[model samples]
Target: MTFTLGPRAISAGYQLAAFDQIGSTNAEALARARDGERGPKWFVTTEQTAGRGRRQRAWVMPRGNLASSILEVMDVSPAVAATLGFAAGLSLESALQKLAVEANMRRAEPLKFALKWPNDVLAERQKLTGILLEAEAVAGNRLAVVVGIGTNVVAAPEGTPTPATSLAALGVHVGAEELFKGLAEAWVEFRGIWDNGRGFAGIRKAWLDRAFGVGEPVAIRTGTATIEGTFDTIDETGCLIVRTAEGKRMPITAGEVYFGTAASLGAT
Candidate 1:
């Protein structure tokens, strides 16, 4: 299937570049940004040979999966630009909801699809999508950020760190192109809501509403130390707020979060 940006995405100043195969969409996008390609563009590929998730973890990108990256040059600082991960996560959640509704496969319970802390989208507590955000400094204090997203549409990798599932595994027969269409359109809407990180309060609220393990026990691993606490709310800067057993609220800026006794860990 040919990948194309929807009218909504184009109207919102998004350009599309589709590839049959690539080493890494995020890498290509960043390379282009460094060469003075200041674009709000989408770098999409059917297959990625060298894709990576957060913390340099290997990202399995099968041929039928969705491997795409959004590159935007922003005036915001790198710290502020990092918040776009929340926007991307919320966008993916919205896109999945739309796909489920279109297939008439809505879950009876509310959280059939939910967002994990930092950057994962889960379907029934199993990971369905992963998000990665990378940023580079440009001339004159401008920063360029690339939001990379990968979704398991037809198949999920086996023996992953966390339990994995796909749309096909869930009995929803959707193609990567179809999913990307929804994702592109939904991204435009969510970007508008984000307003370049100025409107983060609404994004934070929406993300928490669909959060997978809020108010539940979670274990967060940051390097050598592991901290177990109750999953609390996210702060204004999009940090995960974990309330430890000692009644202290610790805001985690980066870590691997595991929920509900899941020993497996994934990057956040």
Candidate 2:
């Protein structure tokens, strides 16, 4: 299918490149950015042969899954640019909500979907979508970030670290192309809310309202060490705030978080 940008996206100077098969959308975006391509462009593919997730985990991309990446040029530090993951996550959640409503899956109860910390969207406590952020150094000390998003529309892999679900499993009959249209539109809205990371306070509040496993027991794995604590709110800097049983609050910047009996190194 041909991927076309919506009117809102086109007005915002967003471009889209769709492929039937590719090594990795994020890799292509980063390569283009390094080669002097400044863009708020999107790279989408049906099959990703060499897709990789956070921490270099292999991402299984079947034919029907949504494998897309957003490349944007930003004049911010890497630390601040990392917050774009929140914006991307929020956009995906909004897009899925629209699809779910259109499919009449959950018209009255829209809270069935929730956002996981750092960059994941959970539907009924199972992973429904994943996001990966990659940044590169550009000229003039600027940075380019590629926000890669994968959603399970028709099928999900089995035996994953965490349980997985798809929109089809939830009775939502939508395709990748249709979903990308909604996603691209939502991206524009959420990016405006983010205001180049300056309006993160509102973004943080919105994310918390839809957060999954907040105030619940959680285990976080940072490298080789594991910390068990209650899931507190995310800090202002986008760190996971965990309150341990020993009355200590730990802010986790990077790690794998597990809720309930989900797998330890779950996909994010």
Give the Cα lDDT of each candidate: 0.88, 0.88
State the lDDT of candidate 1 residue by residue for 14-58, as single tens digits. Answer: 899999999999999999999998889999987999999989998
Cα lDDT of model 2 by residue, 105-201, tens digit? 4455553889999888999888888899999899988899999998888898888767889988888888889899999999999999998889999
For model 2, the stretches where C-alpha displacement exceeds 4 angstroms are 105-111, 261-268
Residue 58 of candidate 1: its Cα lDDT?
89
Error of 2 at 57 (Å): 0.7
- Compared with the true structure, the alpha-carbon lDDT of candidate 1 equals 0.88
Q: Which ten residues in a row have the lowest lDDT in candidate 2?
A: 259-268
